[model samples]
Target: MTEKAQNINLNKAKSNKKDEFYTQLSDIERELKHYKKHFRGKVVYCNCDDPRVSNFFHYFSYNFEKLGLKKLITTCYKSQDMDLFSTNNAERAIYLEYEGDKNGNMLPDASDIGIKQLNGDGDFRSEESIELLKQADIVVTNPPFSLFREYIAQLIDHDKKFIIVGHQNAIKYKEIFPLIRDNKLWLGFGFKGGAAHFINKHYEDYATAADRKEGMIRVSGVHWFTNIDLKKRHEDLILYKNYNPEEYQKYENFDAINVNKTKDIPIDYDGFMGVPITFMDKYNPEQFEIIGVGIANSGLEIGIQPYKPEHKYYRKEVQKRGAVNGDLYMMINGVVTVPYTRIIIKSKKL
Candidate 1:
């Protein structure tokens, strides 16, 4: 498993409350900078946040007129108390709609916002939320981490435009990769340094080199996934490394060279090369063409010997080394070893 996959696994094993991380406003600001043009005259829905404290609400409501937004909507899950803020409120659920500052105060205040009670617990899948979704032009929120696939499916099903938060590893999901392959979805200007700090009220926290708070959990591999267009995504990567067999080892299971780092990509090589997932951050679709992943039987798979992960003999061979998940493999000589799931690419630069 890659470091990212392992971190996600550790989070899953330790926290059943995988969906509770609160996104910080600063992170939102950094990403929203590139999508301002899309919000004009558009209905932005924040289905997974509470307007009272949600930065999504604050960001949109505060800049409502400036962004030329037509409307803004926000909803929260069950009103059951998770903390003092969730307490002192009704036990059901609620939703809010704002049409920007009605008065001339230049702020979206109580008078400009509409608050309504919901019949359901405000589950995004509930009919009540679906009705609201139909009225939305764009959706934005950090949804339940564990239910990311389901949440994204709903948005795509509705054909809604959106900007949402998800882990970088989500790129490899069977349902997601096809969209990427077809250019239906792509990554946004990711959180600074491929990591984000979120508010975690349900558990104890510690400090990182980035923050000194106890309630904050720094999630690495966090990124912004969006269908919106941005100039940065088209910026080409400058490569200097030339293909050298001694440095770029060919994987035994696949007929391709293993590039341990993105920067080390061989500029002269015209063939397929397996590179790290981190390469996606600096990836420019106009420059490098993504082919496929390095999975067994994946259409891009190749070797003198075919890959068979389920073969009884192959399973036993991998078991002796360590836990073997769906990650791709590379053999050094005759020894079978796992490599991080690589994004197979046929360089356009070459």
Candidate 2:
């Protein structure tokens, strides 16, 4: 094999060998307990995992047998490692062949009802995977960070109940944020601190060197986004404080100020309602509501402004041309000019 291929293989080997370093946290355990009760005598699927190194198995193996799970499905792209941990009640659990591995010959135990190996990926998007998703009462696993968006889309599309692990920033995505806003999702308990170790194939010596020093493969704080009950563990942090119309009138150049009110405000306003960033979390169609949200700088006009660079040459050219008044500038990416303004809006219902 080529050197690159050899390296990839070596990395996979190392990850498999050291997989035990990763462990589930208490909050994850609590969530699983809730799941077991809710999905008693139902099938559960763990997508994007090796049965041996899977967080799903680590957390739920004992509980599965106790609850008499109908089936536990796990997959691997290359080899089946489901035999690492043996459960006494093997008859109840079944292993199916993933369709992607045509040559894979792993078979489920006789006690298992049947085999259902089919095509799938770390992202869990295959016909069999979709079928498993449809059949499962709950999906619990740590999906690959690379394809988190697509993975979430599948769950939401199917309207399945799931408790999955992902980067905390996933909550900030435009697509994801709306779900939390609409009360279709919520952040789990123990989100403030983060979760356990995640040993992986790409353990770069330098890129992850700092995290290594800290004794873990640290990604951004891992959080649980779910339609399941999270028990409202974390205290809600307010986004806006001391909000008043007079405080914002001076910065009228901006379009609006986003404020998160601690207490619910009256929605009986004639104008638009500017919900705070926190409003994204509590937004409910039946109760609270959202009109719209975007970049609105009250100080400057809603157009862009371009200024010459601070270099000596640029400054000289600017002096020669005289200071140009506000030139229309192209807003790129997340950068935007906001007037000393706050998001303002009117609310009615509550």
Candidate 3:
């Protein structure tokens, strides 16, 4: 491989190694509680979880009867150990199936659960795992961050309902944004304080001293992506700010007034407005129409044009900071400034 290709592969491997954060039971329960109604009589699959230590397995098995679930299936990638995190050390992997409480003890018992080995390494993309996925009604798991795009595409291609975890930045991805724009997927009731505390062993904690916990990694911008509809999805955001030309700067390349914060979105403005990515959290289709994203390629798709020739020097300056053709920019005090990633939307009600 060329040096560039080798470097990319190395980086991907490093990223996948750091993608082993285990979901906390409290975090799972908090988000699942909001969707209990959707779980009734459904076959739930935790394809990325090891039944031995995964809280996703624990939560579903424990709540199978409570949720009136038809079945609970969990599969581990490779490791068979009961360790805090899997290192994928084993050549083969296993899956588990639980059908409520067979002994009537009101709890999932090991004797009642069925454990089976896979011919393959139990990767979610493996044919054996895909067979299990076909039988499931809802797939729930914390998938690997590095493989998130492919993982989501697989779920979409299979037409399977899912509530999977991923970084919030995935919303802007070319592969993912179209799904959100078309209402095929959406954000779930996210982690507390917009960050998650995951059980982990291989990474150092970068959380503040006040937020740090023993044996856990605090990852910001993590969110649950799901096709299952949420009650909050239809609730309109309470916008209090009124639009003013001085407060909201109009982008020079795109005809949209930029609002730095979601909460500050103007209620009166009916035209296209550019807002931060966090706006997705409060987006209600009835209240606003998602125009398009305002980043390079997506920006061009939404009609964002190149900088005028008169400001070529300014464009060159901003390009050094990662700006490119079709990026949305505006003059702030006579200086060319490219705004951070923005989602263009229009107020439907206004």
- Taking all chains together, the TM-score of candidate 1 against the true structure is 0.87
Q: By the lDDT metric, which is better: model 1 or model 2?
A: 1
Worst lDDT 10-window in candidate 2? 82-91
Model 3, 1-350: lDDT tens digits are: 23244334324434454535678999999999999999999999998788888898989888888899999999988965422223577677999999888788898888989999999988889999999999999999988666788899999999999998887888999999999888898999999988888776656666779999988767677789999988899999998989899999999988899999999999899899999988998888888989898887888987999768756566667555555777788988887887778999998896
Expressed as tens digits, the lDDT of each residue in 137-244 for candidate 1 is 999987766677888899999999889988877888777877876678888988876777677655444335545456666666878888887887888778888898
By lDDT, the best candidate is: 3
Instruction: Sort the predicted structures by TM-score, highest score first.
Output: 3, 1, 2
Model 3 segments beyond 4 Å from truth?
Answer: 1-19, 80-87, 309-312, 315-319
- Each prediction's Cα RMSD? 3.9, 11.2, 4.4
The per-prediction tally of clashing pairs is: 0, 27, 0
Count clashing pairs, candidate 1.
0
Question: What is the C-alpha local distance difference test score of each model?
Answer: 0.76, 0.47, 0.83
Task: Determine the backbone clash count of candidate 3.
Answer: 0
List clashing residue pairs in candidate 1: none
